[model samples]
Target: MADLQDERPDTGHVPVGPGSLGAEDTPAAPVAGALDRAAALLAVHPVADGCNTLVWTLRQSPYHDIDTPDTGVDTDIPRLRAGGVGAQFWSLLPPSAGPHASGAADQVVSDTLDQIDVALALVRRYPDGLCLALSADDLVDARNRGRIASLLGPVSGRTLTDSLSPLRAFHTLGVRILAPGGAQWAREGLTAFGHEVVKEANRLAVLLDLAGCPPVAACRIAGASKAPAVLSNTAAAALNPHPDNVTDEVLLALRAANGLAMVTFDTARTGDSLHAVADHLDHVRAVAGPECVGLGAAFGAEPGVPRPTGLTDPSGYPRLLAELLDRGWPESDLALLTWGNALRVLRDVEFTARAAQHRRTP
Candidate 1:
């Protein structure tokens, strides 16, 4: 396995300036109207962002309170509300190196549990602003109650320590999604034990995340898992050669498996412009259809890292949606991109879990 440090982006927890939250590329009058329509649309069908590294950010900065308007990271309550986020999957990435690295299985599990504690603690600290969501119904309920539905995802298959016990324990603790591997797993592919993780995840109804998974492993998991796999935070590899980006082959597999590829906003993976971000979305929709497309955004980059123009933080989602609306994307398609598709995948995973529970024991 590769170091977890190399597998994911930096979780640098820098305080964001309040001014940065409102910054955006100015739009023309016609485009401005589209922006209004975009905001209104999101008000009804908000974004279910597939991934955010906020939990890691908070862990790194134990004192930073996300309730503050400017928590220094890309995400905070105000920015999430401004971004029209209804549901967010908080990524719980365990240490890829250090004592917790391979052979220190107990340490890795402890590290993962600590990350989950941070997430659950955040939800508890701000019940009005966030709610722990374990099912598709819970997600919708949180949205209706005006809270961002918080879902937990533990990245890296190694976190399981070659056993199913940790996976079940994490689920019991309210983790709904699992990225069985990160970039390293994409390169090495799943082991026999990894395949068992996928099968058990399906039985538990946990959605498999393929954000850092490459084509071969992605396709293999898609075929092997009963529930739809999700690219929690990725862009189109066809556009950019970023290792974390998804390939056309994987996108096709996602469509076949009724999965979703939630496009990311990381400038390194997508591009530096708002149009560049939209291009990846357009390409994914072109190949996998809109139903397979959703927003992951992947916000919370280290400070000073370049973010896409007009999408500097979580609040910039409206601009991206407006860009799509201006490009002739129908509201219905945008609705699916923002919220419906992710909800549908969660419902499917829950249904699969229920059926699997009847057929197997963990």
Candidate 2:
């Protein structure tokens, strides 16, 4: 929630190799052809980036326009198109407790509302480029129209302010994803109230993102919630021992719950190269299955943290996919990683919400 600038130092290009592939490996593709293949694949299955902090950057400066090219941040319309990003989950990370944080509960709620306003306003401001997507169907519709499907995701459960009203309100306003406060949930695990939040999110068709959650809490939420959960912007802790990364236990739980573990680009969580990212992706796919892995670059989310080489911004996805391609990932699996899997989770959540609505009162 601080002023997020693109301060990542340039780590030169790291070549893709067979070393990045997991147990179920295929013969590596020629590196010269991988980029072309990646581009061709992306034409149909554009990247559905799970988390981006452009809203946070926009919130910092009134002059910053999302349509502007090279705004000294990670995301922009032109670069997004260049990156083959068809759908994006715009992360609204309102600080829960900070020196600049609101002391009162109402103010915190107000701040959350303000963040949503910023996201909605961007879509309204750029109707030709971005369209608000509330469901999986909407994402496809937007793609067909040649527009970027924008999904709202308010990170941190504290944004709800210990009540379900705000959660319902966020859903009504087109928020589709809710990631509970990881630091808080990690320390105490999901309390009774947290379970209520998950249940209500399920009913509302809001995807639960377990980005910063620990294994115990992530597994519990995955087990309890009918809808599939996601790690919107996290790496595999099996490779990187960071607190924010997803553990193998959580990955197995995702497999059982049909959830997604979107591999992040944060070098602090994963390692600092394209191959490091591929390694994490391979690990997640090997553990959680390829259906459960996706991309959540989390670009510009942590301003000072180092970004992986060739993945410093929105235009870098094709290169990352090329790395995967060179590592011998099939086109079908790559399609799921880029688009299908996220859409499936959204569809599943909507289905679960409809079923819950038939049985329970809102």
Best lDDT among the predictions, by candidate number? 1
Clashes of 2: 1
Q: Which stretches of candidate 1 lie over 4 Å from their true place?
A: 1-30, 95-103, 182-189
Evaluate model 2: give its TM-score.
Answer: 0.87
| Model 1 lDDT on a 0 to 1 scale | 0.78
**Candidate 1 similarity to native, TM-score:** 0.89
Clash count list over all predictions:
5, 1
- Alpha carbon deviation, residue 257, candidate 1 (Å): 0.1
Give the per-residue lDDT of model 2 (tens digit) for 1-362.
Answer: 01011221232212222233232322233365776677678779988999887787778765665575643565677667767889999888766522123456566667667789999999999999999999999999999998999999854566654568878888888888887744343335677777778788888999998776667778888998999999888888888898788889999999999999999988798887778899999999999999999999987442455787666676677778888887789999999999999999999999999998887766
Error of 2 at 126 (Å): 0.8
